[model samples]
Target: MQCSYFDAGLCRSCTLLDTPYAEQLTSKQARVEELLDAHSPEWLSPIASPEQGFRNKAKMVVGGTAAAPTLGILDGRGEGVDIRGCALHLAPIHDALPVLARFITLTGLQPYDVPSRRGDLKYVLVTANAEGELLVRFVVRSEDVVSRLRRHLAALQETLPNAVVVTANLLPEHKAVTEGEREIVLTSRDRLTMTLAGMRLELRPQSFFQTNTPVADQLYTQARTWVDELGPASVWDLYCGVGGFALACAAPGRAVLGVETSVDAVLSARATARREGLDDVRFEAGDATEAALQAQPGEHPDVVIVNPPRRGIGETLARWLDASGVQHVVYSSCNPVTLVRDLEWMPGFRMRRARALDMFPHTTHLEVVTLLERVDSPATDRPRVRMP
Candidate 1:
């Protein structure tokens, strides 16, 4: 995808901007093959995203003055690069950005100046659902401007009619993270609801969701299809952010449980299951790897589904899965390098099939989903003859 920000020598996030879309897919598939061919040589055609305007979230840095605020990355010299018209964001984000800038201008909210260590507004995060509805959050250094921004909420809402939830996050310290420990809700409703893969899910400001909606849908659909074919009696989803996989895999007789470290994400997942009356699915807030080791007899899962972060599921979990009696494992990884590192421990299982999803376009980042099955023991099946 062509980007004006990249053209003007501003944002260099998209490393493969000049590469053709087809070649980009080929390169990603080849990288995965190089890493995983030993375990799983079978592959499927990589799922591709549209060349432009597929991003459903925008995290724009609040820079410059409120009167003339900039919505993009900041330079080392503390100057802002105006990327409000970036082609990666969806139409709603592109449309709401000018309104958001105007809101900042009208509210007299000062953009946080990193050099001076002053100002209130530091970042503006906006997320869009399938219906183009938006959830906007303003990350500020303190609560000094919360009342002012809340006072002019109507004007911001008037500018962007699709905005359903608006929140104010306070970051009291000079830290690298965008969010803080305390979250002050500015909207009457606490959740932003959306539909994906034929399931309705409610999301909070802090909860994690895929940035690309179409590819995320494809990812969930592919996982659900595989699980449905397996028809496992029980499934455990590890690192289940908001229970995306568990919700899709839950069936009438199947028992599904999702474990996440974030309480907010666990709460969101439970709320979704409760809202849908999914009695067979549940979620817990805790470290998944430790919890799985102590899982009760009744709660033990036959098939395990893991959607781990960039680091992959560390050695402990890999060794546990390798020795566990579980018959099948569904692994979804964002980092192929770490994935291969963890896969080496699972010598007992063989990769049945693998597919790549182009979750982030104009970049090298890709999501891979693989299904692994434990090979039957020789004692369990009688062989006609042994090669000698």
Candidate 2:
């Protein structure tokens, strides 16, 4: 997709924008195939993403005046760079940005000045699902603006009809984080539901959900398919964001436990489970590494699924999982560098199949999912199918 921002040299977030979309996917697939050669020969073609208008979430740093606030990235010298109609954001996010801009004027709120640090508004974060339902959060200096925003909440919500949830986050100190410690929900409903593969996954403002909603569904579906083939009696999902994988893989007799650090994500996951009548799956709030090591005797997982951060599972967790009795491991990684590092720790496990999902089309980012089986397991003895 052509972007005026790129033409004007205003934003180069999509570094690969100059390259053709087809070649971009090929490059991503080639990178993974080179790095994970011995790990998994069986492969699936990279699930390509749209050239533009695919991002489900839009985080625009609040800059300039509230009346004429800029919503985009900060410049090198810490100045607001306005990129309102960024092609990467989905239609709902693009449509709500102007409404949010207008709301700032109606509320008479002042956008924070990065240099003076005097204004109240700090950011405008908007997340949308496939159905175009939106969750809008205004990040501000403190709770002082919360009261003012509450008065104008109705008008804002009315202007942006798709906005199902609205919230305010406070950041008292000067920092790099876009969000703050305290979150105040301005709307009655705080959770947004994303329906994928016949399952509803609820996500809060603070919960982690993929920016590319369609590609995320494909990612979850492929992982669930692999888990179904293995048919493990008990499964553990580490860093389970809103229990997408855990809930999708939940079977009649199987028990699925999802461990995540975010209380909000775990709560949303639990609520969705109750709402969907999936009692076999449960989500808990805790550090994934600690939770994995602390599983009770009867609660041992037959298999473990890990979707670690870009750093991948650190040395400690990787070494622990290497010796853990879990027979199979499914790892979903956004960074191949860290993925290779973690793979070095797993001596007994061998990668069975690997696939790259092109979640970010015009960027270098790629999501690679791999299925691993213990060396001595009967499953590993089967001849691995070769990839094209």
Candidate 3:
């Protein structure tokens, strides 16, 4: 992966240029193993994935002159460095960069200046599915540039017919989040839909989806296989963004409840279920920990699937699951440190299996899926084996 963009000092976002891809993967796998062995040995796995350009979404920082806009990492002093041809993005996105940049210039929308905070457009985030359909979201400082964005949308549609959905996110605040409280639809619809393993997933501008679509499909398929193999009577998907896990486990005569904090995500999940005619699966908007605690005793699920953020399952949620009658838990974590920490809190649960999915390549990050099963009963004294 010879990246001239980085050589020319145009982008420094990927700091792993000096390291080989194989070495990076090995180092990450070793780090994960060490963390799990020292903390939660049972969750350790030796498997790893090959490193490559696995990014599915691109969040470029817009800066420099609009006529010659730069898209890439911010400098040490906070200036956008051009990286339109980054190595981490998929080939399609990389191939489409020049045209996209031309469209941006043709539209005459000014790129937001972080220091001055004057421009209307902050960033242009583009998400592409496995099937090559693109969803474009323009993060703007305010709705003042609606006309500029509209003109840009028309040109983008003409220039890049593959762009399926386009929308404008109004972020008037000076916060770090690219999105704002309000979103204005610049296209025919306010949402973009993608299909994964025969299931449809609706994506809002702010909704969370795995950036790497190929590995994400593998992750979802693995989770589905595990759920089906367990054959649980009921399932509870906590932190179920857009019902990824819930929809994966949908089957006849099996009831699955998905709980998420995002109301829009829950609504999208429900819409997908309705479209698929999957009456057994439903989604609700609420804090996952609170939802789990409030679940009726009789309605307690036999299996629980939690894909929490980097913070991992907090102490409160861990305690709730410790007391709950749930028999199985499939934990998908992006942070190994937090995952091991949470596993230490629940000693009653024994690790059954684990696998590392390389979702973000060219970086140190790794996604781990762990299956933990509750011990039916406590047994008397036994020798404890030290972790390697």
Candidate 4:
């Protein structure tokens, strides 16, 4: 898992690259346990990910001149440090990066110069699905370079046949953002299919999907196993990006509803449900907190699945879930600090079981999923437990 970029100090994204992979996983699991030891829940063995060639997505900052473009992150001087062969990216992404760099040259798409803010292209975002299909996006300052990209799209596709979905995202501002509001499809196909845990999840241009394919599969499979064991009749997936958790939990008689703020993501989720013939599963585009608060009188779910961003659902949603009368909650969080804060908000619930999934290998970040059971009722009440 050696990275020349890390050694040369050109890119230090993987801060723990010096540490052994096994040690990294162990330290991450230990840190999570130390943070959640108060809950005293049963701890499942931590899931491990490959130290290298595991990242399915490559977010390379477009730099250098368009004629000789660099595909990687910007340096301290805001110039691109070429990492086309970064070890973290999957094979497809690693192979396609140089081709994409050439495409930039062919189209004469100027790399956005951060210091001067004079160029057109900002970033090249490439994603690879489990089937080896690719979705390529070019984030630019405006539509000024759209014509060039569209005109040469066929040649680029012919060279990179695996590129199924190609789009140009217009980020007109000079701000430091990944993408913008308007996404123009350069190819006939608009969505890329990610088959995870036996679910054909459609991915729109702006849709969210886990970067680590194998680890993401393990996460969904673990959640599905938990839901099956619990056998909840109805489940609500909050902040459901592309309905991964919701679709994973859907069953014969089970009703699953997924709520997300992104309309594109909601549309992708619904399409997946329809393609799978999941009549009982539905998706809505709205704020998760508002959707939860506006649930009909008899629409309370038996189980709720929340996979929030690093913020960990915030206090408002946490407090609402605390009093929602939901029997159980499956909480997946990427930040243990925020997760502990949210857990403190739900004093009436007890963490029954928890597991750590090393989705971001060679880094301090980790993903943890916990089963929270409402133990306020006498029938379900149990003494606080401790892990020996």
Q: List TM-scores for all candidates, in order.
A: 0.94, 0.95, 0.90, 0.96
1-388 per-residue lDDT for model 3 (tens digits): 5678667776655567667867776787777777766434354343444344567788888777779987766787767788877767776677666777777788777888777777777888888766777777878877778888786677788878877878888887777886787778788866668677567798776778888777788788888998999998788899999999999998888888898998878888888889889988988889988986666553457789999999998998887776666678999999988888897778778778777776766667889888889985533232221111
Best of the candidates, lDDT = 4
Model 2 misplacement above 4 A: 296-299, 377-388
Candidate 2 lDDT over 281-338, as tens digits, reads 8888999889866654333477889999898989888877776667889999999889
Task: Write one digit per residue (lDDT tens) for candidate 1, span 24-55.
Answer: 99999898888888885479778999888888
Model 4 scores a C-alpha lDDT of: 0.90
lDDT of 2: 0.86
In candidate 4, position 318 carries an lDDT of 87
Order of candidate numbers by TM-score, starting with the best: 4, 2, 1, 3
At residue 54, candidate 3 shows an lDDT of 62
Clashes of each: 0, 0, 0, 0
Model 3 TM-score relative to the real fold: 0.90
Model 4: ten consecutive residues of lowest lDDT = 379-388
Query: How many backbone clashes can be found in candidate 3?
Result: 0
